[model samples]
Target: MWRAEESKEAYEELKKKLMEGLRENEKIESILKALKLFNSRKDRIFKEVDDLEELREKIRRAKEEVIENLDEYIEKAVKKMEENLCKVYLAKDAEEARRIVRGIVGDAKLVVKSKSNACREIGIVDYLESQGIKVVETDLADRVVQLLGEEECHPVVPAIHISKEKWSEAFSKETGRDVPPDAQAITDASREGVRRAIMSAEVGITGANAIVAETGTIITVENEGNISLVSRVPPKHIVIAGINKIVPTLEDGLNIAEATTLFGTGQRFGAYVSFITGPSRTVDVGLETTIGLHGAQEVHVVLIDNGRRDAIRDGMKEMLYCLNCGSCLASCPIYMSIGEKYSCGYFGGIGLSFGAYIFGAQRAFVDGLGFCTDCGACSEKCPAKISSNDLVREIRRRAWERFGLLLPPHKKIRDAILETGNPFGEPPEKRGEWMKSN
Candidate 1:
């Protein structure tokens, strides 16, 4: 799937389709609508709180507490998890993560997955499927894009750019059957199909929103209950998550969850928030503890680094602090205009730099860099104050040094000024030709 020819063709086709469907006026309308909804929801959520600033400060402190003693917290969590009969593996990178999962899921033919950016980060689905596992995405948006053989276009709402009309068409094409374009019918059809997949899945995987070190529990919040179904019905469940998701306590996890929900989906809380400690167990009939009553019999937590530790060591720890709220995607003008093809695995301003670094800096820096308009809206709304614009510039500079890519357009304008002493390159005297004293 990552072949150069296929990747290039896919990129070109995506760009053409997006450009044709998303005009400047339509982009403006979408942005306005999204901003209105986001701001209204933010206001409603923040209105009842007595001291918003205090809450933010407390959350920041909680994050600092974890970062200051990361190792100790991880050890504590591992020990607690082991006591709960849950297997834990700490992966130094993507390869290690893949190995750990493969060992646990040996010979499993069918696997179902929740919508996890982390899985995409490690190329989990593709790798497992290549190894002869039939992997299926259970999330509605994820399933839609996967069935269409397309990459995700947004971080939070993966298929928001797809209209209901197009969704119906895609469903019809994929299913080889006539499907109505009516919204309710389309939704029901998709849901029923995925429901069957979830029930029969042998192994289920999900991403962690937050991990409570104190309780050794992982939390996942989603609008659809698919994640719960996947994690519960499957015989084995694996949670692939970044190490930085660990929090010091359950309260801290809850606080992070609330902020993430408001920032990500413009909701106070998601429809389902699953806090799983270990496999489901019961001691009823014979007074013998038996696991897998209602939930997965075996649970594994794979803590993946995959360059995150290196990013932290290089002083990019703030990026690790992200709750995956995806607020930046909603607020980014570039993302609103172009959709997921431009953003890819990660979305919005922050994703541009991180995705490029992890995926391929040269390609991302040159192709994805120009997508951003240097609009400050994303940074302003970001809960973490991550300077995404600055990171993009830095990545572009590195790309030029490493791969000899072209400088960004703004830099070219600046270079012109330095070479000719005038940004316009016209005669200095002619600079005032258009000026008229009123």
Candidate 2:
């Protein structure tokens, strides 16, 4: 759908924009501040719960069990989904998924999409546009970035890297009308623009935070109401989600969703939580079954593998447990400093790992992984405790093995450290010479 070079360029531009948003001195401080807040909140939330550690262990086991028996679970999910009259498709890669969506949307001019990083990861917008479909992102944050024709810097807050003033200017240009540089004015303009897309969209696409295998339900959570509009207003709704997002039951899905919301955005619950089971159906008058009256008539769920199965087999399965809350991105020192360019896809710690495998290490390489300060802030704040820093190190090692590419400054510093104890390689006696003289 999209070339590797184009994706790399997009990532670099986003990184530049992110760095421009932060003050030189405030970057690390702000990252640490956010980390502290997140850590404190997590400690408080799980402090009194005596069984949290046990629950985490159980979840890990459950996830592992599912993965171990992945084929069976996938079959069960497909059977259950089909039984409910909803279409289910298994896409091995991005191309198949794109083809399925394009076929379903056949000649549709207007399509509205919810904020789905999965879709973004697969290059859905570029693919659809290639087929002459006009896809509009309905999420306010997504809409802002789409109008500006830029990649998202943050997963949760797509436009967080952009200031309100810039948004006001963008809105003024898009609407050809005067707009005040105020929060309300900017919000109103974005809302209006997204609303129009939602109301007129012939097809809608969204990403599921979790899919319940037991109940054949797709779970979506969002702070903005755009997800609701995306699912309800359009005549046809399609969900593109990673296969790892599946859970054994609705209760398990709810637990994962709740934990993601709490830790991801520091919220008790999202503003809109939509759980759609099959398409809208009613058997009211004279035992006649009706579909699509209240919401979308047809619902299609595409379980995408891409490289997730390989990742799971490679012992990087823990990454599949991500809820895409983007908590790590907010707290990552590297991400805060370099912004979105730190990685290729998704953003933040997980993105780095995914980028290495998906985009390849050479194309995704940035600053020899020196962008990361190894502060462990991202892992500390990650609800899943994903060990992002360790993953980055592994990625770097893999890069060297695969491409024989060494990270620039880090390679030099590492060699210096090996030759001598200090990175500067100054004589041991000179280490204290400056202190003694000054």
Candidate 3:
């Protein structure tokens, strides 16, 4: 389990992990190699776009509009979904979300899930496990994390820090077989494990990549086909997503999904995109439509607020525009050094801002607010044009205001500039002395 960011113990542990992560040459080399591969695919995505900048601008404007009028859009989405014979619930926080989910799950013994960072954001996995529900993750990376009992290191690649040998060992233990230390072998084992879990599950829970307000459809994009099986095979389907994920129309939702796929994994499109509009229905038996004819009988959507509305009120509204594409994580130098151990909640640069607002400013500070370099790489790669560097700087200023925490070096430099009018602590006349000789 990941430690709480606000605690002193967690702060100390984060420092230790950061040091260890930086010095591990093998891990560093693996991550750098992954980065190279990602950038190569990312370049190809840009090459295929006719007007990437125009599309980005359009998405930015759309996101801003949606966030600005979030309440109205949510209301519209709920109404439309209910009209499609789907149940909808609004949760103000994590606790409320978990409670509503439990009610929907009722007497379910086994639950299957797809890849969903939003579920992590609400602590749903832990909550369900505590309630005695056997929850299984179907995503390959998520499955690895589950078996290892480790926190998700990256949003897209949850077990990116784990090597192939480690994964092979985990799979061998899970299946009670001598598994080869090969990528395909490990994946095949995971597929078998997840398929069994899905077949036994009574309830299926997932997070939506995008929610269409006009049609009340939930859209999910994935490379693995697990999401498809989990949503279809079960008798009950539940979608838990943030209120900010709602878009005005299906077209707008697809646009956002396309950008997210391109920026997240550097793909032209996801391998599988599922558009679900409610429970499964068939009219073959008679003239009337029959629910549960092939797929799920009931569909439930829970939209959680969890400090997001408060974030807007606090002037950190721009964060709501994030597509969770994870491009920012790949570009962050600090993230590359410390991995996800320094993460407050989400991954990489944007996590700093998310930590401040969602997890609290004090927690975020002790969690490593000063680590950011204020570089604009994250901003440049963001599909929605969010300036995460600026957000980090803003959070840094707030940290000082709230807790008076400042790096000793920065404090000394500021003091020197104030006292001697030079960062070198020299008189103004000597400021150019080095330039004269060198």
Candidate 4:
């Protein structure tokens, strides 16, 4: 408040105006409780870390090194991966990325994908499905979310908003199989459904945790082992990764993966950490190399720019450092309280940055990015140590500049305050009715 700055004062003032009108949202109560338990479990798992800051520093150095030399790293990665026999394409935006994917996936009737924020950011699954290609989510929670026709809230546990009973209902409805409300039955049923999809799918699409520039390795971490299958079983694999995922070496990538799972789900070592140098090949028989040995024969890596370069260019490089760990969402009070109401899937602080930097302000402000309470909890819990407050402020500023990025509700409140000196729009004299009664 003492900064004497118009934007900060106006931002906080607007935030106050928004929060003053907060109401009890009953739908999120159970979800909030569930998130609490989930956080506690994550905390227990993370408590075993020794010298956490040191690990974070190592991660920071690796990421910063890559970010500082993003173009150089990307060039190196592309060269190495191409030399490894993987077709690499760099897309300037989401549309081009989708276009390239469509071409790569030409004539494919069915495709399966693992959970990926980049895929979500580009709406690739939906885009592909729109082109008459069937895309199934292979990740357990993601599959459930797809079956439930819901948007994922948390990146790591996308289906956490839905109960096991709800999942059972969705699975039963989807598979036409007897899946009881029990976790085991639900899990078994989901696994069976994903396995069927995996077996029948013609292609697999996944996002990379890290793309190593040195060895041209694509690193993906998962606990369900579904990522392993989804990226391998099909004859063709399409890897969609933001250029920000590129690190200098396999060691850097592994460290990133380690941090991702460690912070994402408290798994020190996830069940499967796949390092894909190229499509699976065997050189045993006759000293001849043959591709497609229990893995994808054709591998296409789409290094999506999609605003990542813009993020770096515009000095919002911190956005590129994100691990997609969802730790910030888990720790943000605003998110925990009202869930997606605070920010729609991938449209909150980080999502806002995603929208502002890459997708443009129009794409982000539609979700009402103004809901961020500026509590700094998200920034605190973020393993990458990105400042959501600063990012949100910048997004708001740029968005305001572009299109007045003010929400309809906020506009109404602004009008109300100007006309009636209060947000409530009741008769001014009636405002003191409660005070008189007390």
Which predicted model would earn the best lDDT? Answer: 3
Better of 2 and 3 by lDDT: 3
- Candidate lDDT values, in order: 0.75, 0.75, 0.84, 0.80
TM-score of each: 0.84, 0.83, 0.91, 0.86
Top TM-score model: 3
Q: Which stretches of model 2 miss by more than 4 angstroms?
A: 1-62, 366-370, 408-438
lDDT of 3 by residue, 286-364 (tens): 6788899768899999999888898798788888888888888778888777677557788776887887777777667
lDDT of 4 by residue, 318-436 (tens): 88888888778777766765566555347358877777766676556545477677788777766788888788888777676666666556667977998899998767888989888
* Winner by TM-score between candidate 4 and candidate 2: 4
TM-score for candidate 2, residues paired by index? 0.83
- Pairs with backbone N, CA or C atoms under 3 Å apart (clashes), candidate 4: none
Q: RMSD of candidate 3 to the true fold?
A: 3.7
Candidate 2 local lDDT, 1-438, one digit each (tens): 334454455446545645664554444444455546655776676665566655555555556656777888888888888888789999988889988998889878999999898898789999999878899988877887888887676677666656667788888987789878898898887777778878989999999988878888889998888888888789999999988878888877776677676676566668878888888889987899988787999999989998888777766777776778787877676676666656677677778777665555655565224355667777765656677777777766766666555544455687788887899977677788888877
The per-residue C-alpha lDDT of model 2 at residue 386 equals: 75
lDDT per residue for candidate 1 within 73-126, as digits (tens), equals 889888878777799999987788998999988988999999998999898998
Please identify which of the two predictions, 2 or 4, would achieve the higher lDDT against the true structure.
4
